[model samples]
Target: MRLRNIPGAKESLQQHPSIIIPNPSENKGNWKAVFGNDNPIHVEVGTGKGQFLIGMSKLHPNVNFIGIEKYDSVLVRALEQAKEEERPNLKFLNEDVEDILTFFEKAEIERIFINFTDPWPKNRHEKRRLTYKGFLDMYKQILVKNGEIHFKTDNQGLFEYSLESFSGYGMTLHHVSLDLHRSGMEGNVMTEYEQKFSRKGMRIYRCEAKFRA
Candidate 1:
């Protein structure tokens, strides 16, 4: 993904203190205080343009939603879209995936969503993939016991690789779909990339994996 630097994007995000969490590391374990409630927190990692997070926030009003995106340019687009709505349960985080553990404590997050993350197709970059064991281990640290990961992608290679990664890590898989759109699955939320790829006749793969004790 070639990203064009958006001038003042970082400045804009900083200005919206209510929508964007400033110094997320400080509020690590006390996320409920940030939302002013004890409702279960669900996060979407690599939330490009925030379509899925925004939609989920509105649909599930009782659940708090956080969208984490690393790039300022791409995150700014999500911020702009979220600004139009008055969602008290929705927030955005401009942070790298590698520092994820620093922003949350054990059993802090109830659910995680990974939508169309970068495949990092090179074998040498396998560890960098979001579904890689390294990343999964990081997720396990913050996620509650039995916390679930919902993942979807259009890349077959990444999907296959992720299936193995999740299974190898002892995550029970369910609702595995090779062609999500045609699978007639209900309550499916489409991300920006999911919509774009599905329109071009690309197959979307989806699965739900839960860490078992």
Candidate 2:
């Protein structure tokens, strides 16, 4: 997906102190202070256009939701959408996932959502996949014991690879679905890409994996 450059995206994000956190790394280990309550923190990596995070924040007001997106152009759209809704429990992070550890402390996050992440199809780029062991290890360091990663994708190859990766890492998988929309799962919030792809007859795969510590 080609993203058109959104002028002043960075500036807009900086201006919205209530919605986007500036220099989030400085708040590492003290995220609960930022939220002003001891609520379970759930992060959505690669939150495109912010639909899932926004919807989840609205549905679960007791849980704090953070949307992380790297591209300023893509994140700007989400920031704009968030402006329309007043969700105190929701926040956005305009940063790369590679520095994720620097933004939170160990066992700081309770859950992670990887919705329609980039497949990184090339075999050489397998390590870059969000479900790769390296990333999972990082997640384990930040996630509380029994915390789970909820993943969804329309790419079968990526889904298969992720299942193998998760299993190889000794993570337990549950609620595996080849067609999430047809699975009749309750409380599933559809992302923007999920809605688009499922509308075009694409098979949506989903699963939840946890590293029992």
Candidate 3:
């Protein structure tokens, strides 16, 4: 699918180097240097408009956060929100997840967040799903020992598929909620899509999975 170019989006991202790191690959394994501290790094893959990541960053000042978005146009919106306050531990990556290994070394990440990603419900596009085994393997390599993946989605099929995929990949699941809003789970941050969907009375499924050591 072709994405419509947003006017000045590219220029906006370049203007905010503090919020969006320029040339993220240069930092590589030494991500601590970027934030000037050794706090554990937690990454949010596919951070659409950065609602949840930004909220989490505010809620946890001690933990460093990186939000990865594929497009500069969409990422600019996240940077806009990030700039609203002083978030020294928060940063944005205008890059693709397929090249995630290039930006971080083995066991460099403490945790990962996958919120309201595309389900790719078609069977043929199963591999494109974020929870697919291939993506999980990539995540495992970069995550620290017993690092957790916190995932939330509005699709039932994808939730079930992800559960099976995680189990097949030897990942342990915890806090699996079929309806997240009413589950009374604390510290729940809502993404843009999640907020919209939940307002319409749609069910939200969430789970935390950890890779085997």
Candidate 4:
């Protein structure tokens, strides 16, 4: 379905004015107050085409979702799905993840999902990957004690590097899987990238990382 033509999307989003953060720089420090809910907040970094975010929003209504995508062209689809589902619990930010801390208050988030993030495949570009220590450190500040980061990707090197980064930062790893689709992992929801890669028989990697309390 085309995002722009999603029926009632314009109106539904208007009623839920806070669903889109217009000026993330100005409001990131007080996001919880803007959301007006104490429900656990979960973030999906690199949310593409909105499939996973939309699907998970439907599955978990009590938990609020904050989808961050740098490209507005991609984020519009997420907004459309949220409107179609009337998912009162979903919001979106169209900005780079580097400034993610600006949009979320300290200890405001409980969980984070990193799905199919760009695998900067150069030795020098490794620092640009979201799983790099710079980004993870930002996440640590916004996530409460023991808050977890869930990562899924098809890139082998990125996955291996992420594991090392997490370990070096003293993160506790749980529910780790090297070949997720073949690991007998049940109840795993498919994201757009996961669906495409798995259909072509590509293996997936996944893990749950948490700060040690």
Candidate 5:
């Protein structure tokens, strides 16, 4: 984060009491109500510093958004961004994604976004990746049939590995781009990391996986 965005950031995070999920399990099936919307729900896993979800919520008010992050420090920064944006349709969960199923019922989530997720490059830590089968299985339980997962990363290894994982899970793949910024895909929301890395001319890999019914 820039020094310009730091001042008053702490106070801004305290402003939205309802947006922070203190107990994720206790909020089971209550996410839609939290945003005060019955529309389709879109969630962002590992919302580092909050730029992506807040930006998306600002542009698309009709759709609801929930950002989940495990690190309190990281989440605090992201929460401040969401607060600064004053997004009515955006909320957050400060917990591990393993609790996502308990917080949402079957087919409750309509779309999921995983942007610049941890690559977990080591073979021993493969399960920690958000696209890992364990995590995908958990996502599948809550995602509606035809629900989709959007991902963008600069890691070729993770991108290739994730495509195989999605295929293994029988997902329908679309928009498989090895260099997203140069792929001519318009209307793309750039995350803080994407903006930083893309400026250095790194090719960004992206894909969307739909869990077919």
Candidate 6:
């Protein structure tokens, strides 16, 4: 997706320190201090527009939600919408996922949500996929043993590739859905892309994979 550069988007994001964390790497293992509670923290890797994360924060008040988006233009939209609601449990990280391990120490994260990420269909670009083994290894470092990754996408090829990746990594899959909207699952928060795709009659795939204990 081509992102249109928004003027002052970076400045707007910086203004909201309470919502957008500054010097996140410094927080490291002190995320509990950042949130001032011991509530489990859940992160969304590519939180486009923050629709799903925002809705989740409202639905699960006890869980701390942090959204990691690299682009200032895209992240600013989430920061704007988040201001309307006073969510002490929600925060944003304007950083690349490549350094994700630097922001949080081992076992710091409880759950991860990856929704509608780029398919990167080329065979050579397989390593760039979020579900790639390399990316999964990064996730394993910070996630608690038995921690879960909940992934959703409209791309069938990526879904198939991810299933194999997860299985190959010895992760156990649960609640797998080939067509999420028709799966009768409750309390599923839909991302902006998910809603748009569903409106166009696209099939949505979803699964929850857990690291071995």
lDDT of each: 0.94, 0.93, 0.92, 0.83, 0.86, 0.95
| Residue 159 miss distance in model 4 (angstroms) | 0.5
Model 4 per-residue lDDT tens digits across residues 44-93: 98887788988888888888888888765676667777777777778887
Report the lDDT of model 6 for residue 74.
96
Can you write out model 3's per-residue Cα lDDT over 1-213, one digit (the tens) per residue?
466678999889999888888899999999999999999999999997998988999899999999999898788888888888768989999999888888998999999999988899899998899999999989999999999999999999999999999999999999999999999998898999999999999999999999989
Model 2 weakest 10-residue run by lDDT: 1-10
lDDT ranking of the models: 6, 1, 2, 3, 5, 4
State model 3's lDDT: 0.92
Tell me the TM-score of each prediction against the true structure: 0.98, 0.98, 0.97, 0.88, 0.91, 0.99
Superposition TM-score, candidate 1 onto the true structure: 0.98
Question: Which residue ranges in model 2 land beyond 4 Å of their true spot?
Answer: none
Task: For candidate 6, write residues 65-169 as lDDT tens digits.
Answer: 999999999999999889998799999999999889899999999999999999999999999999999999999989998999999999999999999999999
Q: Candidate 3 or 6, higher lDDT?
A: 6
- TM-score order of candidates, best first? 6, 1, 2, 3, 5, 4
Residue 22 local lDDT, model 5? 65
RMSD to the native, candidate 3?
1.2
Which wins on lDDT, candidate 4 or candidate 5?
5
How far does residue 141 in candidate 4 sit from its true spot (Å)?
0.5
- Candidate 1 lDDT by residue in tens digits, 1-213: 689999999999999989989999999999999999999999999998999988998889999999999899999999999999879999999999899999999999999999999999999999899999999999999999899999999999999999999999999999999999999998888999999999999999999999997
In candidate 1, list every pair of residues with a backbone clash.
none
Better of 1 and 3 by TM-score: 1
Task: For model 4, state the Cα shift of residue 184 in Å.
Answer: 3.0
Which lDDT value does model 6 have at 173? 99
Per-residue lDDT over 34-112 for candidate 2, one digit per residue giving the tens place of the 0 to 100 score:
9999999999999989999999998899999999999988888888889999888999998999889999999999999
